[model samples]
Target: MRPTFHLKTLVVAVAAFSVASIASAAGLDRSGQDITTFLQDGLYAEAVYTYIDADVTGNDNAYIGGDNNAYIQGNKTGDVAESYDFFRYGVKADINDTFSVGILYDEPFGAAASYSGDNNFVARGDLDATINAASDGALPNYAQAEGQFDALQQAVADGATLTPQQQAQFQALGSALAIAQAEQATKGEGTNVEVRSESITAILGMKLGENKNFQVYGGPVAQRVRADVKLRGIAYGPATGYTSHISPDQDYGWLAGMSYSKPEIALKAALTYRSEIDHKMQIAEIYPVAEALGINPVQSNTMEMSTPKSVNIDFQTGINPTTIATAKVRWVPWSDFEIVPPLYNEVSKGSYGPDGLALVGYDDDQWQVELGMAKRLTPALALSGTVGWDSGAGDPTTSLGPIDGYYSAGLGAKYNVTENWAVSAGGKYLWFGDAKGQLPTKKIVGDFQDNDGYILGVKLSYQAQQNFN
Candidate 1:
């Protein structure tokens, strides 16, 4: 007799691709929070690894400038974002018939990008376009090295002999000129960036009644966030030399959910809610060398970063002897989430603010929906397919994250290696939505359209039966 699972493994394959991530969703939501670690039966441990390749493209334009002219005519900013590699693991243990415990680890949110290359928007010395311009097209007063030289000549002529005081003043002026010129020399060289976060959760489950049809679970969640950023281009203005690094911080949240399942028919329905995690980050800010001209050069800044609140509903049931149907709906309050350090607010010119506008925050929440089905073709093999849609956090978003939303499709295959082990492979493709990257002046920086993302993943699971019955 062939060892057979038939339709028993349908839900497992479908659940793997039910998540939306990469450049597909809103905010920094990278994993889609698909908690499959605790969805299996018996004493189980599982590991999954994923790789994502994605990019965004569009024309650069300012939303606020008069005539609404384009900022970058032909060159696109995000050709291919930094590739992302992620890993997740979970283990579950059942202690008797009424109590079970599980622990899970995953990346909840992240972002990575680089804006370097030849383009009119990011050429070296490009910042001087605005910095060197005179008021109303008139020659600026002592704007260049030539002007500084002329001023130094005038000072020498006025001095009767070389006094020590006058010599000291001349040295200071010379130093200031050197600093000013060097500041703009490599303005476009270091424009890379990265932001990352991870989470760990411990869960407690209790069985209600005797049949074990109802299970209630709750857990405490902990997450860590770290980021480094550097900005340039004419859009940044005096903020062009702005660079920031956020020291990592760990914070806590909570999750609660309930599930009703009938194993005989391979039916399961779960609703889970995860609370928002808040972190107060300590930051080190460095500025355009000119900022050194200020009274204080190095400053410490603190910003409050709240992850987001989310709800997920998942359902799966055997459609036939060999097939199972699965679906999911997820909601996240992305509009309420933001990252704005106090220093960014103090330096950000125009309408950008910590209270009203943001360094990077959405104008609305996000909603994601997906539908899929899985079928067992042979006792050792199963196949699954899924389609999904995400209503992005907002439209006309910030350059930091300029995606409106996406439509996605996926495929997966699972092969049972033995009675206690299985290996699964899966891949998903996303068709990203459109958005206009904005400046504080409400100018459109980039019109990102026709973007895409590709993700590949694999999973391994082991089940060990320990019956104390």
Candidate 2:
């Protein structure tokens, strides 16, 4: 049977495009004013989609016996993926040649689904034997064979002084029960974690210069960031309880920028930057049955994370009156990024101890480039195409989250319906790179493969000649 696209898939694609559009606009000079003016003056609205995929691999060594003595070997592996879509509409009115005001609404950020299933990492049947042996060897007060024999004797004695044959059967059952209990007390749950974030931003712009070549602007950037984290197939040890839910966090920030152009050379360039925003998240630490399910919620804590800063440069020059070429380069400093929550820190410092803390080391920095050309097919139509590349953040990636880089190609067109009205549409395809990360425990690793995405966008605008006395 042929596969059909779902409505959610379409929405995710559209949202992803919107994010790219916002990033594109945010990186533009003069607070993205030029693009806003171009759109608003034409009385238009825009819709966009953005998508991303990432893979992670890692190994973690389980330390049983209450953070000391006992040790058991285990492994884990998985992938993280997502898609986002956004739609926006706005209008611009010129107060004069030197100024204009506009308002826009768009979904700035959002995330879709993720997966981390258990395969080899879960030692189901033999887990009891392995954990029992490790705990008995490590714990100071543990008595190996003697403790097992004593428990067996007690069970036999309680069975109304069992017959010889029944006594043997009871003894064997007792030993198995003892071992199961020992194992249950020593095994540490392995980690198979995933997380995602989505948000939005809005702003206004102002222009200054005879030819509108220079401009400055700023506005409130409202954002909503949501994260879903899961740690599955865990083995519970004594002294530790686990929780499953981590609530989503939301906050707001602001943006500003400037631009310059030399019309004679048909050359233009601009610089834009966004400030970092913080989130204090409230998360559920542990559940009542966590020990049985191998899930633990760290103690109460605040999750502190922020989106990185970006810089973009755009250049356009006329090849002739009928054709123009444009290019863009963007820089995102992901290396400075960090996730520190009170609960995470406590778990690192307390429970699993130092080894647990090491998993927190992560730094990512990325870059992107784009090139495009627009040709005037006629007085009312213009056609354009662009290709871009986004570099992946860093090596030995983390399962904490995945936002790998990609290769993208896009096509676009602008149609002029009248001297003062115009409409534009564009679509892009992205090929994502694979990603992997190492688990703190031994023999465990996660892998994500074959990541790709797509985007579509539409924009409309109108221009009104201003009157001055």
Candidate 3:
């Protein structure tokens, strides 16, 4: 009974704080591929709910100036992110002692941010100044109009009094100035952005040899993604007043892994690899204001959106009769993830992206490490604690995801209510590393410092055994 009950206690402790442990680990990574579904001993099912909140404070500055965007001007706060909830569900069945199969549902990547307050955190740069720059790029006759207006002004300054001919010329210059003012009206404000991704994975496991001590597993995975970004203040000025939408699209990938275990010592190690999922999605760009500038107002095009590939190495061993030590190292190649819209590439070729780069991308890969321990406190209760660290991909991070790195700690507990039912809960707090907001130009927009985040979660697990004759 003691050995049989230990499985339930372990499931609760592992699944309790799973969401809290990896809510903000890397680029758009909400879950760190914990693979808790494989921890079940037999037919098992689990459900989890998590609530995440983060406080990221930074200031916005005048875009016309060359100073950092985090300068404390008049704005009080730029708390663009909001609190949200997430859920996970899974089921696994052991087909005899040597073979097992399982399925898992989780949200791997997501983003949600909405700027609030009277000030324009949604668009921090100078609107008037950006129009001046945009006019030069989008307006064909802008310089000619300016030169004509200048010559008329010089004539008025030289003459003592205004003649009829000179007055008519002045009227013509006024008309040209009106045209410039109209051009300025075409610019608009950027408001908010929301992006989401969900995944479902099916897996199968087989015993390695006659001893049935080693296992190998592989599976097929599918995911869906949707995103909408309103550019009230485009970092690239000429591309402002644009909204980019990627309707929910499905993509496919695969995962494979092998595990080794020693039952007598309760030691196990597993290595897993997840392939990148590529999406060829149709993008709709709404540029109501862009059309006024003689650019395409409505555009429909297919784009290649690919998520990063990752590898996970997980290990655990019983340190003592009542304690277990566990560790994990995860690597993600985030430098491969890129979002390049058609119109953005067209305008940013010479202006924002000197090397013809993406609208948003990272410069380096990402890595995360976690060390933790679990202990049995009572016959039916177990407790766990963990500490983790993430090496930020780079400094001067994207405004879309401003965190540079993080140091985090978590605590969890599991309680068995009956022979077949168990409940668990946990929470994690992270001290986020600060970095400057960078644009496509690779210039610092502002500095974000001293921000923090937290996640709270609860989970339930049920075990069902079936008899076969």
- RMSD of each predicted structure: 6.4, 11.5, 6.8
Which regions of candidate 1 deviate over 4 angstroms? 1-24, 62-74, 78-80, 120-123, 132-185, 289-297, 349-357, 465-468
Is candidate 1 or 2 superior in TM-score? 1
lDDT of model number 1? 0.69
- The sequence of per-residue lDDT tens digits that candidate 3 reaches over residues 373-417 is 878788578888889998877787776677787899999887878
Local distance difference test, each candidate = 0.69, 0.47, 0.69
Best by TM-score: 1
Of the candidates numbered 1 and 2, which has the greater lDDT value? Answer: 1
TM-score ranking, high to low: 1, 3, 2
Query: On residues 224-337, what C-alpha lDDT tens digit does candidate 2 reach at each position?
Result: 555443333333222122233447777777667676655554445666676776767765554223222233433555566675556656666556555656677767665666
Model 2 / residue 192 / CA error / Å: 8.9
Off by over 4 Å in 2: 1-45, 49-80, 88-91, 104-113, 116-204, 210-212, 234-250, 262-267, 287-301, 351-361, 400-404, 416-423, 439-444, 459-469
Candidate order, lDDT descending:
1, 3, 2
> Candidate 1: deviation at residue 432, Å?
0.6
Off by over 4 Å in 3: 1-19, 63-76, 118-120, 123-190, 234-236, 288-294, 350-355, 464-469
Q: Who is ahead in TM-score, 2 or 3?
A: 3
Ten contiguous residues minimizing lDDT sum, candidate 2: 25-34
